[model samples]
Target chain A: MELIAERGYRRTSLAAVAERAGLTQQGLLHHFPTKELLLVAVLEARDRWDLASSAASAAGSWRTGTLAQLVDYNATRPGIVQTYTVLSADSVTEDHPARAFFESRFRAVREAMAAVLRAEFGETLPGGLTPERAAPLLVAVMDGLQLQWLLDPQDVDMPAAFRDFVALLGRGGD
Target chain B: MELIAERGYRRTSLAAVAERAGLTQQGLLHHFPTKELLLVAVLEARDRWDLASSAASAAGSWRTGTLAQLVDYNATRPGIVQTYTVLSADSVTEDHPARAFFESRFRAVREAMAAVLRAEFGETLPGGLTPERAAPLLVAVMDGLQLQWLLDPQDVDMPAAFRDFVALLGRGGD
Candidate 1:
């Protein structure tokens, strides 16, 4: 993941991964036969970490504040955020192996977010948007802030921007 | 730009760019000496197109609606957006050639956006947030929406979502 995050997926070969992990190419191949497979594992591992941490923080349920807390947590780990930003952008192509994973992952995220919004703001949110409609905007803002922050951390305060967004959500219907 | 957008920066060579442009490698390199230089030229060209269009649309000044119009225009050009997405992600590295360009561009964009917001909503916006503080959020949402729309055009309505964000901004102090 670190290799791919630094050089992007296409440039990061399995040999480099083996070298970084201190394993022979054959040894690495034995564990994950292909680069694509290794990528999938890396992605899955990241998701697992997010889930475990979220679970640990919220007792297995994602609250409205969970997303904000997650943003705060993300600020601490530039590597993971960089990896995700690089891979997610790469995955948008039609032939990218991670395309399906991100597509479904977004759908699931939107649904989960909408549920959280619904819990906080009832059926409809501010500006006459349903939770479903508001959910994607929330997701987009977070992802987008990561991109801007990664580019210029001195200017883009990830956590403060996220808190402002949360405040935006809180003031939506009023 | 299309070749890099499709294949990503590291994987794209001068040969592929030359082939796409119907020029020999030497011919292409005559203009852009190295791959990094070529990438920089492509980014600058894209920005030129944007400035040209924006200037043409708003008489050299941007308005609140200009952002939405830009998003709508962006929807018509998936290739450019994809190139930007791919390159921007790749540029997050500390030493990427385009790093300074994006950093400064964001600074300029945020200042310009804050100016627009202040013009439209005065110093303090809804929720008592200043326009300067609000500018990055607007920029973040626009870029974020692009990522989601690029990934799932069928499911994500880029223009509508942007319009919705504008509406959110308008209702900020109401």
Candidate 2:
């Protein structure tokens, strides 16, 4: 991920990644047969890390739940956010390997979040905001907030903005 | 822009841009001194086009205006949006030329939007819902929606979602 950050994904080779990881090229290749595969592994690792961190944080509180923690987590990891932004934009085409990974990652994340929201609000949510609708809106806001933060981190009070947004969601009904 | 879209940006050259634009290599060089300059020009052209198109659509009807139109315009121009997203992410460092372009572009767009929003809403907007705050949120939502739409156009009803959000914004103080 650091290699992809410093040198772009295309420029960062297996040897470079191995050197950065303090492993021999052969050792790295044993794990990831190709650069594309290695990139996927990196993405998967990030997704797993985020999910684990979010889950751990969620376990601690019901009042200040996963949504708040997710916002905080995003605030701290601008690099990962930027990398995802760049890669996702680049991976728009049908055949891009990263596209599938991102698509599934996004779906899983949305579903997980929707489950949390459902658990919190239950039938109290006005008109009963379906997970499908609420999930996408939440994800869209987060993604959008990240872009705003990237453009001007100082200008965007990300956690506060998200907190306000979630508060509105809790009230439900536009 | 098409050349870069077809063959990724780094792989596409000044020669290719010239060929696509129906200009001789010398002719292209006469207009743009370097590949970077050409890329900038492409971005500038897109900016100008978007501004003009948005301005035309936003010309009349101060209140109850069509935010949906704005969303639709962006949805149709995925190429321009992708170009900006890719360049903006790459331009994280202060020294990158595209960084300045994006910063200026964002500022200009936000300011323009604030003016429009103020005109539309007058003083009815709630406390803390100033144009400055609202403008960035609007841009963030637009950007966020675009990312989601690009990933799965079928899943997102861009204009409807935006309208719902805007309606929520209008009903201030939650």
Candidate 3:
């Protein structure tokens, strides 16, 4: 699947997608009636792969190290990362189809991350933040780093920067 | 003027701009031959507003508190924040007109942030990160937080979280 979503969804047609996939347009529509549906399917497919890994790590309890590992994994797959980076930003637009998906996803992600923080640090983390408070910021650091890395891969060492952030998190808050 | 950029750039027409601005289409086109020029004009116009403030703070030496203040300013202007949030993400696409603008902007931003860190922490920061290493991550956190805030303003307290991050920066490395 060409998940590189630099091309906004509006510009991509079902016929183009069908032609690209070597499927009849009707066949493609039978499965996904709209371009937005196809986009979400692709997003979900990507998330499934990610969720599987996160599930594996859940048994061990998600740690800063696990997040750092995920960052390392992302650095290896620019196409996947770019697809997400572009789409998430696109979702912010008014009436974007992906908005609901992202909203629910972010809520779940923050909750999952909060659970991870709680498992690791009980209630308050080392820097004196509750899990609820730190979860969004942790997610933000990852999302923000991906944007920078996608834009300038040579200058931004995403994995290294994430490691640094994890270390900073370990330090007690002033 | 309509910085609420849920409407992607391509969909926004020159006629619409001219109509909205109470200018003739010919007059508007005379000033900006292409829509990209107008987009950049809006971006630069916004930057000019922001630059005036950052310039004031530069004399006092850019500090964490100054950044926190900027976040507070962004909180008041959702339209302005949404415009930047949408455009920066959109710029990641193939052949996006805003791509060059963002690339150059990011470089300058990182350099400016590095200078700020160097001023605050000399060679290295509290967590043993060099000003150069931390600059991009700092940028990432802010950008990332903005995405989360735009998506869920009711849930995310951008300014407080930034203050917390500033506190993290003040702590020594583990």
Best by TM-score: 3
Pull out the clashing pairs in model 2: none
Interface CA root-mean-square deviation for model 2? 3.6
Candidate 2: tens digits of C-alpha lDDT, residues A1-174: 777667654466899989988999999999998776787787778876766666554573333256688679768766667666667665664467677776777777677667767767664343345655666667777777776677777777888777766765666532
**Candidate 3, B144: how far from true, in Å?**
0.8
The lDDT, on a scale of 0 to 1, for candidate 3 is 0.78
* TM value for model 2: 0.80
DockQ, Cα level, model 2:
0.36
lDDT of 1 by residue, A1-174 (tens): 678657754567899999999999999999998776687778789878887767644565576688888898889777768877877887775578778888888888889888888877787666787888888889888988998998888888999988887777778474
- TM-score per candidate, in order? 0.87, 0.80, 0.88
Model 3 Cα lDDT, one tens digit per residue, B37-87: 787778788777776768656575777677888999988876657667777
| Regions of candidate 1 where Cα sits further than 4 Å from its true position | A1-22, A33-37, A55-60, A172-174, B1-13, B16-22, B55-60, B172-174
Worst 10 contiguous positions by lDDT, candidate 1 chain A: A55-64
Query: Total clashing residue pairs per candidate?
Result: 0, 0, 0
RMSD of each: 3.2, 3.9, 3.0
What value does DockQ give for candidate 1? 0.51
Report residue B31 deviation for candidate 1 (angstroms).
2.2
Ranking by lDDT: 1, 3, 2
Interface RMSD of each: 2.7, 3.6, 2.7
